[model samples]
Target: MNDDLKQAAGISFIEQTTLDRATIRTAYRPDYGAAPAYKSYPDAAVLELPRAAWQLSEARIINLLQRRRSLRTFAETPVSLHQLAFVLWASQGVTALAGNHLLRTAPSAGALYPIETYVSLQRVEGQASGIYHFDTRAFQLRLVVEGDQGSGLAAAFLGQQFLGQASFCLVWTAVSRRSMGKYGDRGVRYLLLDAGHICQNALLAAEAVNLGSCPAAAFYDRELNDLLGIDGYEEIALYGAAFGAKQETTTPLAGR
Candidate 1:
């Protein structure tokens, strides 16, 4: 039978490596002090994020979905700190303490939340423009590399000018050590899936706030890693998105 023959034949090297590349990518990299499961900065000055409201808008699921669009254009207006916090929380905020792990708005394999969020703030009110690491445990922003990074990020994204014009950018990096330590090669797949969940939440949250956002994966890998100052070996930049206020030219909601 075809089923029997298929079972007898094993996966080709191409097939195997394709699925396992995520783990192999980091496995070959020289160990970088084995990143801890939960990443946070103890020394950096932290900006306390206001507790985000649960009901940011009265939008229903249908409305949020219909309004969602991958907008490239953005207004020059500065997004408020509160608005930023709400979007950040919706994306990867810690919701509950589930024993040893903290449950978030998105789920992860084996509850190993391997994705760490970093942001480049370009025009957030009352916040300096710089690279900041989100401290999910404490709900705060820890300053990492300070100063405007719009131009540099735009270059890393292959001259995607829209990135530089956005109010802020959310960079999601996968600390593979957290997942690969347990799940091995399979964990890499989990990391990619987790990023999608987090990004989608961001999109919906942006719509609720009437902000424009575009999730982007087409970027130069090493360049982006260097931009974020993370080792491309262990903590690799897997996905990201640019967010800002909506410009008049942004596409309107679907009429369906």
Candidate 2:
């Protein structure tokens, strides 16, 4: 983990690039230390989903809502590329118009939209396992991590085995500046609330597409932020939702 990479990843902790080399080396042990960036954030790129990706119907949406539940267990079924695209689109993609700005599924305080989405791909059919930034405006995923990033996700999320088995995991991060620039301390509160709204929408969107999902808040903060190349203070992990097919024997929930 070098200082140059930290800056590109939008990390805010390092004081100077030279100091980071020694700091990162000493911090390396079992769990602490900066994680290498998965990939560079590409300029805004628009993705064109096949025409068939738009074939989902309204009846399917309602059925999913009625059957909504947190699915902890997953089948070994691999999610299709189109299905992934659909949920991503439904969750935070721009759905309508509001003058010059765009509208999305979940509402935000003043529509500041402080929440950013990242995906750790594992079992999607057409995509490789890696980190990616969800470009809501372009309705596409911009690749960030270029290789299998699921293993690191499981570790960061407190050894959540289900996270690794799932086809994809969505990491919700907050860009504090977007809100804090206006609301100050209150911005912190709204930033978290906004993340919740986005996660719920993602869960519903997953159900609508016949995929299972579970929202998680338990994880190592700095570890996850580094894996996603996010600066802990400015943009950090808020929550994660694991999605995939559910296997019957995978124990949906353990007794508390």
Candidate 3:
């Protein structure tokens, strides 16, 4: 193992740190002021996604789970707008609101839901190639930056050319203050685990739609954050996944 891995392993043991009691008390305290459950881009143009008449295929949840795999190669065909919406919904769609809290498809610590989903569209039908923020509350996509970002995304991902070729890539960012405010330093762990839940949902959702997905944990952090126009300190990129139609003969996951 490398020095970084060795150092990380040394500190991996669990122990009660100085902030344990204080952080736990703060997290469980009632009536604590919290950040809004959703992030909004008010100035951007919102393209309301198609909610009626979804074209999703019939696939057993067990079958989808069994077939899930990291798909790096994608066909040149474009993903439909409906399919795009379905994947986004599965990943971070809001199901209901209870008082001040929003319940999502994935569970979150304290329902703080710190993860934000962004997309770099390369080949989605009825959508321009650009960066968009998934507005979970509104069920719309707020276009952030206009124009093609395929090559830039690939470069930011350390020359993972397949990322640029995929129909769209999901970029997940963690808003530190959302979790950290409650759990203190321990919130960092929650942030990562929450991201995993979101990504797994994306993967299974994509598979159900005959689309393939590949999760990527390695990338140039500063570069990706800059590309997504997020300050690395406050909201930073944590994970990413590329999705597109699977090549012929291999059969797209949706058709199975």
Candidate whose lDDT is highest: 3
lDDT of 2 by residue, 1-256 (tens): 2333334323332222212222544753455768787965578686867644544575676677778888888888889998888878877988789987688888999888999999888999977788899999988788898988878888887778888878999999988778766786567778779989888888988887789999998777767888998776667678899999766655567685
For candidate 2, the per-residue lDDT at 167 reads 93
Q: What is the lDDT of residue 170 in candidate 1?
A: 96
TM-score of each: 0.75, 0.72, 0.75
> Which of 1 and 3 is the better model by lDDT?
3
Which stretches of candidate 3 lie above 4 Å from their native place? 1-59, 250-256
| Candidate 2 vs 3: which has more lDDT | 3
Worst 10 contiguous positions by lDDT, candidate 2: 13-22
What's model 1's overall lDDT?
0.81
Q: List CA RMSD, all candidates.
A: 16.1, 14.8, 16.4
Q: Which residue pairs collide, candidate 1?
A: none
